[model samples]
Structure formats: structure tokens, C-alpha cells
Target: MALPTGPATSWLQRTGFPSQLFETGDNDYELYEAEDEFVLSVEMPGFEPDEMNVSWSDGVLNIVAEHEDEQRDRRETYHRRFRFPKDVAEDEITAKYTNGILEVRLPVMRGATVSGTEIEIQG
Candidate 1:
């Protein structure tokens, strides 16, 4: 697809996805871990609830949204994936979309811990 133009640009061209988010220097998608759950909020506008899909598989969260402008013959698509550091209760995971923001909550399983080794800088 052709890149967005300077003038007459639509919201689809602004923050339609992770691609345009960096240009604005704002946290379009925010992710943080609370005491018991991981929360993530993504900025996505101009899309109806039915036009989006949120799913979880293999410790990863996937978000996909699309908008089609039939009159203009244009299609907009957004896809993003997030991998968790700790084990999550996949069955209890939930998500919601409101006012253009998609928020997902992943409950961390009890006694589940992150497995990783920290690396030290070598001189």
C-alpha cells in the first residue's frame, strides 16, 4: 500500500496501528504488570467491536483489527502480538474495547514465576 500523505490524511493514516504510533511520541499501547495480572491497553479507533479480534494461544496475545471503506475501495488492517514473561491463567484472560482503546487483562497463575537469567555487562 502507498504511504500516507501529508495533507488530507485520515485517522487511518495517523494512529491506525503500531506503525504510526512512534511518530507521535506517545504511548499508544501501554503494558504493565500488576500484582496479579498483566494489563495492556492499545489505541485503536474507527473500528467497530465486530471488526476486531482478540485471542490468546501459547502464552501470546494477538490483536487484529480491520476497517474497510468500500466506497473508497480502501482497507486498513492492524495486527500485534504480545508474549508474557510469566505463566498466565489462559482460561481467565479477558479483554474489552471501549472508546477506541482495547484493554486486555491476563491473570498470572498462582506460584507462577518468570524464568530468566539476568546478564551482566562485560568490560
Candidate 2:
């Protein structure tokens, strides 16, 4: 079968899963930048660390989580993607899950840009 073309199609294609099986979860994220690094926090409840997957590739941070509650006959899948900042050190990205909250830290390079610089245009 042929895949649809447009924005977000790339991400969906990468999953290789049927569109019907994909459901949006209540995955809220908060990003904060400090002098040293960028901290990102995502709220994902009812999930264990082992049930989640996080990875960085091609300047994109992708997060996926799947969980099933047998008692309630409920299942959940989370898929989230973020375009990482250019100055972030992808190799140094670290994450931890605690109390259903996932915290990811992306350390900024020594000379990372915290803001845009205005360049003068010469006539």
C-alpha cells in the first residue's frame, strides 16, 4: 500500500504501524533552558520505565510508550517527537523516569547559542 504524502507523514511512516492503532495520549511536555543545558519534562502516567522508549536521531527526539492494564482492559500508546535545538549535544542526552514523569536533559555545547544575533546589513 502507498503511504500518504505531506507533513508528519515521515514520522508516521517511521512507526510502520497502522494509523488506527495509533492513539494520542495525554503526554504534556515542559522545556526549560539553563546556562548549561536544556531540560525537558514529559508527563506520562501509568507507565513503567521498561515500557517506554526514547531516542534521538537526525535532530529529532522521539518518545514512544506502550502499556496495558489487564485489570481494566485498557491499552495506551504514546508517540511524541520534538525537533532538538541545534546547540544541544545529542550524545549527552540523559533521561530518567520517576513518579510517572519522564525527565530528559540535553546538555548545551560550550559555545551554544542561547539567542539570535543581529547582523548589520551593509549597503
TM-score of each prediction: 0.74, 0.69
User: What lDDT is reached at residue 36 by model 1?
Assistant: 99
Which TM-score value belongs to model 2? 0.69
The stretch of ten residues in a row with the least summed lDDT in candidate 2 is 16-25
Expressed as tens digits, the lDDT of each residue in 2-32 for candidate 1 is 6543433556445433233223325669999
Clash number for every model?
A: 0, 0
lDDT value, candidate 2, whole model: 0.77
Residue 59 CA displacement from its true place in model 1, Å: 1.3
Over 1-123, each residue of candidate 2 has an lDDT whose tens digit, in order, gives 854333345466455434445444444888888679888899988999999999988767899998876675456678888886557788899999999899999888888664557789999
Q: Provide the lDDT at 44 for model 1.
A: 86
Could you report the Cα RMSD, in angstroms, for every candidate shown?
5.7, 7.4
> What does candidate 1 score in Cα RMSD to the true structure?
5.7
Give the range of the ten consecutive residues with the poorest summed lDDT in model 1: 16-25
